[model samples]
Target: MAMPAAEIEALIRAALPDAEVEITDLAGDGDHYAARVVSESFRGKSLVQRHKLVYEALGGRMGGELHALQLKTEVPN
Candidate 1:
């Protein structure tokens, strides 16, 4: 089964309640997605760390229910 955009947003929101998140279906397949996240939590984090935070939010689903996620993370300007 593929993951839903709303669910992906929810997962991200749950992990970082103050995040401004946008989830896009990259391939029109529920499994592939792209997410842009802006949050205070990323203030002092590196790109790897930011991506890790998002992957963690998915609870290790990166290679399974959730296929690919191209993510962009930034601290709100």
Candidate 2:
């Protein structure tokens, strides 16, 4: 099963309402995606913690419905 980009964005937004999310379909396939998420919530958090927040938003779909995600997270300037 594959997840849509909009759904992924929606999920992240739902978790971090202030987030700025950009989703890209890496291989033009729904299974592979790249996401850039920026939010104040990521401020002061470690790299691993920032990623955990995004994964938590996805609700455990990372390896199931979502095959691969190249994720980047940052605190806004």
Cα deviation in Å at residue 64, candidate 1?
A: 0.5
Question: Per-residue alpha-carbon lDDT of model 2 for 17-61, expressed as tens digits?
Answer: 999999999998799999999999999999999999999999999
TM-score of each: 0.96, 0.98
Clashes of 2: 0
Worst 10 residues of 1 by lDDT: 58-67
For every model shown, the clashing-pair count is 0, 0
Q: In order, what is each prediction's RMSD in angstroms?
A: 0.6, 0.4
Candidate 1, lDDT over the whole model? 0.93
lDDT of each: 0.93, 0.97
